[model samples]
Target: MPTILHRRWLVGGAALLILLALTAGYIFLTTAATAPARARIQAAASMRPFGEVDQEVVNARTLVEDTPESARAWSVLGLAYLQLARETADPTNYGRADEAFQRALDLDAASVDALIGAGTLALARHEFAEALELGTRAMELNPTIPRVYGVIADAQVELGRYEEAVASVQTMVDLRPDLASYSRVAYLREIHGDNQGAIDALELAVSAGGPAAENTEYVRVQLGHLYFATGDLARAEQIYGESLARLPEYIPALDGLARVRAARGEYSEAIELYEQASARIPLPGTIIALGETYEAAGDQGRATDEYQLVEAIQLLFEANGVRSDVELAAFSAAHGDDADRALALARDAHVRLPTIFAADVLAWSLYRTGAIAEAAGVADEALRLGTQNSVMLYHGGVIAAADGDTDTARTRLEAALDLNPRFSPLLADRAAAALAALDN
Candidate 1:
């Protein structure tokens, strides 16, 4: 037990012990401002593959060319590009989307689709203020639109307005019970500590969004993730396999399957799956997981190699005008020994998003920086949702212990183990050791 509870992060074992208390909370997204809107358009955040949804884009383009002044067609094109941007993780697609949406607005100053499209793009780009403005305006223009509620809900959660988010999603579901509404409901349910409710809602979404293409594959992977979080590896694996069966080489499903492998102590297999996932996405998180699993298997050299890739990726993302603070903060916190760097990255991330994920990293980073008092406050905030994140609980527990709150510390550490004892090969043992010390 040491500073930041890395199992080996040994700046101050005594301080880590003292900080090992307190817990509970959710993991909600962050953005700001609230606008209520209602209109009759299906949720458009499917984020399908470019090839699969290229037809819609082409059709929209054709319509615009044939009818140059058609705001509807222009809005459709904008939305298409927005989805493409998300699917491809390409920033340029956002610019194209913005242009199309602006054209729609120019042609029809009051086009609700254009407004919603713009708002969606803003949400994607982390422009919470603009997203809120557009969401509110779209709502006023068409109060019955379900997608408006989604946009409003996303914005509200980012702004730390959980109450409004709940109400917005409620209105969305009440309007129509579809894939989008149900998925939001599921995430909100998880945030509220209703794992079963979240699972049930996703089940509904899976059933509602069948046919096994992009949407179904994505939902199934998410369902697998929930299952993994709850320590149901068998069911999670089944879901992931089914998803992969539907969409061979689906990266998310591959990642989920890899996680299941890691949990089951299938180290080599896990590494293979994770490597495949890395080949597919090259996301920092995937690389970090690969390294962590390698560490779990005692492959220290390989782990170091993977950890080194993080800085290069960060540099690349920066060069492309993408900060990606959340992932960077997480990567630094997990892999870097310099607590100062982790704290700096986490502080910036919290300022940018303020989501529970950011809050958790900030709390841990504060702990790493020896700001035990500050860490306690942010750790408390991180647990505001009663989330089942074992790492978050472990951090809160350790912080509480450091603060001399033995009861709170014990409870949190116990909860972390109960939620998922194997959450981190590194931290799980540390959590166990901390609990044993508390017992002594």
Candidate 2:
């Protein structure tokens, strides 16, 4: 009886040992299966919004090669490439982003996120037609998706369909109510002569909360521009200062602030800002601002240097197959009386662009050269565009007065004053004098 009891105990011990071994094997297999997924998740979490995350995402792309079916991996790749494109502005980065987005689309053809990214790339390239098509298709594929409408709105705006752009942006606001959409709507309103509407839209944009840090800074800069355009120089200065506080190197804000200072007759302050902006982006606009400010400060030599720099920039753009006729004409007209070189440039530029503003410049340049009859014809063409721009109206008034058409000159000059009495004190004073002479 003792032997039989000992054998039963041994059998039970063996069974318990087998059960323990099986449980250990199951745990090992489960952990091994989950290890790769955990690694992928960790890698994704390490990706930042706009910095080193771009490189990390590129590295993650290699790891996901074996997991081509991973939709989330493709999505991460797309986002990383998009951010890289935004930071670098290298069109090649946009091309890479497009491939990444295409990969995401391949993984999930109905991916609204991928569609939006692709659409944004098209928009950035100024391929407005393609952007509109892609954005519309994306929206049709998924109406509830965010940001697609914003892309469409931007495309429409570039195409000069302002009303349609506004409607599309409004829909985006209803769908996502984000800052990007709101800001775009504000720009459209501002262009449509609704300053108050622009301010209201921008205020909503400020409150909309979804703006990324860079986007928030940009929106503030845009607000400064809106204020400047509406003649609120003080408010413009304040907004630009706020943006510079957030992003000290923001060129657009710096330029706007400089313009405000120049308008307020603070030439020294304006020059400093213009120099900073010029160092960053030596475009024609910045150079012209700097030249004008220097001239205002009675620094003739410095102003000449700035104008020469502008001429060099124009030559560079022309070499690159990008025309700056309008800018050249305006520059020429501004300094034609004192610079023979400027008058020659104005005539050539006016012949190229042939826009109303260009015509006005050509007319002014001709008038400086004692070519009143030629100036009169070009000025008449300029008025035919019916822009109602105060500067253009003032130019028409000047041309009419030069041609001895007192009635027409008074009409145009009065129109210019009614549009903006403070358009330019010099121009306004001239208009007032011309009208007084007509009355006499």
Candidate 3:
């Protein structure tokens, strides 16, 4: 492995090259009409922060207030809002981002910055098609910009266009192999069942680093998740712990440590960690994790309360025009909340996105509602990408068993266990029991 100093030197050189390339792209793409606003916004992007990007939001908002007619100013505000949303796990920022981006587009429909910002917001809201469209438009306007390809690749991946996503990610990394592009590479590698390759790419991303501590820690948490997913609990815990040590109570690191604790059967510790995360930000995923930890610890009442909080957050998300159907469908099906509603949400999500994850949730919901054959078919769709996600495998295994495909059930269940025996505190044991029953 290269030393951290060596990696930093390489990244610094590459960043210099990227800066020159981006400068050229900006010159070529910027018109006299938008040049001033665009230059100011791009300059603001270079302001390094200690641990948060909220300062960017403040700066952009001030700029927009001063120059209300500047489309680029509004676009940067939208982008900043999106960044704040990611850091805080506050879905309400989605609404602010949408409004700001829309205003930018209303002022200048051809603004590439606004288009990319809207695309990112759409991606966050699970509107894969819209994200793809906006990203494509941005690329057409300014193909030299590397980050546009990140948006395109992300949307392509979610839309199940794996080959296109791969090509886009390749182009991105070739243009600028920084944290953003390298992370995309890692994701594509992971979905192709190449865990080690993914880890290698993510390590490179970490070395490339980011302008904000949150950015680096966010990638670190993802690295930890990959380790945890592959059953390297100790490494995952170490990574999460180190991240939390560097940035006290970072929500993603806290959640990761909680997961590691739960996997190790330290339910009390897991519960405490998750509660801390939830208190910091009532993100649906954190709430769901807290609920599941409670369920694992035999605290049904608290678990139910946490689950209800998730429902309330979902409602808030919907009111903000952010879609949560796929997530809600999977959660409802898993918890036996509302079979009909879950199935409906799953179908709607699949119709809108048709992603592998949506397919998995649809399959799970169908199975929960007793549509065994249909569920099996959808489960196959979910596995079509050969992604090595253990939860999807577990769902596939159970659905196959229900559909009377004993061989497939055994194979998928075995694969899930082999990949990660402790994939989920709530479901891993159930998967093992099902596999044992099949053997019997």
Q: Can you write out model 1's per-residue Cα lDDT over 1-440, one digit (the tens) per residue? A: 12111112111000000100000011111222101000000111233344766776788889889989899989989977765554444445677888999999999988999998888777665566678889899999998988787788777776667778777777776777777777777777777776766777777777777332666667767788888888788899999999888878777788888888887789899999988766645555677889989999999999987787655555544544554666679878877889898999999989878888889999988988889899989999999988877888899999988878899899999998887777776788899999888878
Every candidate's CA RMSD: 12.0, 22.2, 10.2
Q: Write the per-residue lDDT of candidate 2 for residues 76-105, one digit (tens) a residue.
A: 676666655443332345556667778888
Q: lDDT of candidate 3 vs native?
A: 0.77
Clashing pairs in 2: none
Q: Which candidate number has the best lDDT?
A: 3
* Candidate of highest TM-score: 3
Per-model TM-score, in order, reads 0.84, 0.62, 0.85
Assess the local accuracy of residue 346 in candidate 2 as a C-alpha lDDT between 0 and 100.
Answer: 74
C-alpha local distance difference test of each model:
0.72, 0.62, 0.77
lDDT (Cα, tens digit) per residue for candidate 3, span 373-438? 999999999998788999999999999999999999999999999988999989999999999999
Candidate 1: misplaced stretches above 4 Å?
1-50, 210-212
